[model samples]
Target: MICKAKAQWIGYPPGSDTSKAWRTGDVVIGGAAPQNAKLTVTGNIVQTSNNNYFNTARLYMQSPGAIPANGQTYATFAGNTFWNNDSAKWQIANSDLTHFGMMRFSATGINFYTQTAATSAQWLTETDLASMLALTMQRGGNVGIGVPVSQAKLHVGGNGSPIDTIAQLSANMVIQASTGGRTTDRGAQLEFVLPSYSNGTNFWGQGRIITVAGDNIHGNAVGKMIIGTRRKFNKLGTGSDWYYGDDIVIDGKGNIGIGTLTPSKKFTMAYSGTQLNSTTPITSEMVVQASTATRSVDTGVALEFVLPANTDGTNLYGHARIFAQAANNTNGNAAGKLVLGTRRKYDKIGAGSLWYYGDDITIDETGNVGIGTLKPTGKLAVNGILLAKQVKVSQSAANWPDYVFTPGYQLPSLDSVAQYISENKHLPEMPDAKEVETNGQDVGKVQQLMLKKMEEMTLYMIDMQKRIDRLENENRELKAKSNNQH
Candidate 1:
């Protein structure tokens, strides 16, 4: 019914006052108030509709609060429950019903949906909502994004991507001052604060700081990165400073420095540690270990240093690799062989790689060392000539030449020695040139043989001296007899 009341109009059932009405089919009021007018309702209103009803609004609740200000309107359902008695779904739609959203309430949970197309819609539950985007404070009060079990105060799940989890980005990932201001000391920084304890002793801690910046100190603009450490206290009177004047530095050219910032090589490490003050002193500070227990065919470990192939704009020069490898070659019957050598890529495009002459130094499983070869048959084998300052050969007492001076020793006569040398062109007990050419001479045995020859020559000289003494005495007596006859 339409109401055109000047002040107010009260309606009621028949034979009943407006305050107490009992007979009611529906009490509907419809009116259009002028501008700046208010229509207030203090009772409840329910709109019932049929199932699958489309393009209908069950309620158009609006509230335009105070004038001369931007206002908001919302519907409030206070102290009321919505129970869908049947399985009939209640949906809210636009006037044409082409795009709509739905909400369903059941004993299990509430489901919210949004139509994706004309006939398809995506539904979401509480678990789906949590997985889609998470903003959680865990049991330990750690806040996180996309991480339910946070391990830090502010954790972000990395999602197994290349970029960092939490990144501050612009053209690049940067933490800088605001564009509106010019601040000389504005840069990204990560600080570590250590805990303090009350005790008679003081404790110092160490931390690392890394920085990346553009540098043009060498007249070329390039990126320079440095990693340094800070110590809270040290031997220099308990004051903190950057350690070792920048512990590590990497330049645009890819040169790295450990202790010296001005690195001369591709990788340089300078040691400035304490000097030795004990009986056992350290001569070297660096060690590279390549260890393995079980070795098979084509399986080994090595410490290799490789140099890239050098080129002069067009043609390739060479590449060098130096490695110390411990290998067990089942095919070659070599087990536990240690080889230290260098290989070079100096062949032509179609040829194979090459190694410099006399470059390999190998020690076999039996401790026999070989130079310029992989397999060694003796204690020391060298394929090339060897130069040394001096050589010493040790012999046992039984193998020495002192037995040549004994009384029972047999000495060959000069005529026998001459006949043997004339026929064989060598000594009786010594090797010939052809034999020496094939098998190298044994230094200790050769020295002993030479000593025996010297001792036999001394015996021959003593026998000749005795015969000369008798001839001289007879000549003196014959001269005395001739003088007495005269």
Candidate 2:
């Protein structure tokens, strides 16, 4: 029944007892006037019905103008609230004016109740709210999924646990900026701004911003991306300051850098340390492997080098590759060959068109290394002149020229040596000038032959000295005999 004016009723209606105050009808206590009527209920407004429609009571506030800001000016409930009793308990205060628009449910103990939205079975029920309340009480702080928990802020998971905690999605998860037209502005980014502390004083810390768009992961910063520490002064009165360097960085073009921010290649590393002093050989720093069997196809692990074009720009610099071939035996007879060379086009000697150059250095299955040739004839074959500071050739006893000084060695006569030199234009057992001009001298063999000639010439000089001594004695005796005859 609608009560439009002031009405005071002290007693219960008809057959209703004090336990059942007013039975069976919708009750409206206020009038249509703006703020004229007031309704005060000394007892609890209870609803006890099995019917689904009218089994609930709602305190609906309707205002023509602005509602009062003070919650007490509106409806208030003051009682010991019980939910499915003994399961949860809380106290409500109508006089709590500071918290104006909020519903206060101060738990009587560790137990509390909360209501969720209506469903098909019930208007309101304790869905997961009870569990949520338990978690809040247990954690003693706010709960978050993707941030850190602070004194007042309830940030979600701080250590990457949120990803695992979230339900798996069937499709890709795209966090785009807008749902509209495709543009360069569409991307996802995560930023971190941490606070730094020194001696209990807080300072502005470094910030790192990571963005993902298309196929790139970009790292950015407003100022320097790295921060260093300052240490106390030492005995020399010099304060030690650590160098600021990039810990890790990757550009949009898939270039990765370690200890450097600007990487010019696919992967670049910059580091400073003392050279290893150990006598043992060290292992390789990096290794690239291709395990696929692509003998029929042209595929392998290649370390490619591409340099910029020249100033004229008429011809771009060609690529050079050091590659370990797969099973392909196209260039050589064997498979799995190791090749190092450029791919620059060169005019074939007796061919029609230009062809790509072959390997500058190649190693065959037999462990023979070749330079400037794919097929090697020996253990090491160089197609060009080899310049070296020194060359030591191992010689056997019979191969060495030390036999020239042996006791039974046969030395040619000086006259015969001179006759051979006059006829051949060279020393005995030595190549002539024409032969030397045609073929380059073998350094080791040439030195041995020269040493032999010098040893033979020493024997000739000794024989000449003995003949001169005998002639001098003969001359002295002849002079003495001539003096006696006189």
Candidate 3:
């Protein structure tokens, strides 16, 4: 079955049709003739795959009820009944938006309701749409890539889920810096910029994050990240514009470098792009690496913590330090020593010099520790006062004073003891004042000698007691004979 009809309507020159006269059956269809044959009506056509007729069940736009004071006509959206629907009341008004000093247009702006409003009176009318909308290449707007609505300045949603987690694929952006050919690629740098005051059109980068190929080889692209900031100076620019300098770096080896690109340890804080093995030093460096070669005795690493005299950062004194150095300058047999030192500050009357600094504790290579002295002669040495609740001294049986109670032990007579003390001006077997002063007294040795003296005093007291007892017995015998004679 084939049916064909050709119809054309054309108005005369300078003629128009403004008539709203009733026109319903102007285009009608009947029977099977209208089923297969295609009747095309000229309008803004939305393409349908099957090329079918559109059902006119939905209502068209309502007439404008009244003109507002702004001389704008508003109409309710067609077929809007449900709340939170894809419906918006539209109007045409004079454009008054002014931004960037370019051409301004206002009739193209749109608005919608996001909240639940049951009726027309419950709707909150928005008089401005520029603040809510994220325009493309326009001011007062945010840009969203692959996002239905964006809340940030720039929201990018990438396609083809780069990760296995489906829920997390909602807001994610991945950047890949690759060279199409077999060439070394400098990794991508993302810069945060701000409009410069010198020129509104130009922008200056304030900070940047750069990702680099960890291995310089073409195919092997281990990732290294650098986060940098722009300071007052630039690459030969006179403080007008600035470039980025690396402030922190994380290499592919999982080493974090705070001030240097190459970190030797798991976490390294080098100063001014240089490590501790370098001779040249920067003035503003907080961490220092001294000279490596030609290093002499007492030369190694020293981390000093200094305290300022006042809030002005002047008269700084080295308050404390963790210092390690080679005690002996010999090549292979260099004795390493770790020293803990504290600087003591003294308040002067008028003008006194000298901030005091001395080693509070030291540990040497031979495992000898010195409390107040750097050079320790024993396993434990203290040059200051030692306080303890109890002390134990171990001595051999021959050295102990318990030998005094033995029968074979020689106990000096009282006459001999008196003579010996009068001659020596000090106790026998005890160190004199001069010797004790010159060489510090050993606690264990002194305690042993004192015990020996105490034991000797006990023996002399026993001998005197025996002599008194003999005298008493002789007197008693004499008195008994006298009484018998009387």
lDDT on C-alpha atoms for all candidate structures? 0.55, 0.51, 0.60
TM-score, every prediction? 0.41, 0.37, 0.40
Which is superior by TM-score, 1 or 2? 1
- Model 2, runs deviating above 4 Å: 1-255, 258-267, 270-285, 291-299, 309-317, 326-337, 347-355, 363-368, 385-403, 406-486
Model 3 has a clash total of: 0
Q: What is the lDDT of candidate 2?
A: 0.51
Superposition error at 215 for model 3 (Å): 28
- Provide the lowest-lDDT 10-residue window in model 3: 96-105
Give Cα distance to truth, residue 427, candidate 3, Å: 2.0
lDDT of 2 by residue, 349-421 (tens): 4344564645788786677898877677666767778888987876677878788778988889888988998
Number of the top-ranking candidate, with TM-score as the measure: 1
Question: Compared with the true structure, what per-residue lDDT tens digits does model 3 show for residues 380-464?
Answer: 8898788999888788878878888889889877788789899999888788899988777777888888988888888888888
Off by over 4 Å in 1: 1-301, 307-334, 343-359, 479-486
Assess candidate 3 and give its lDDT: 0.60
**Per-prediction backbone clash count:** 0, 6, 0
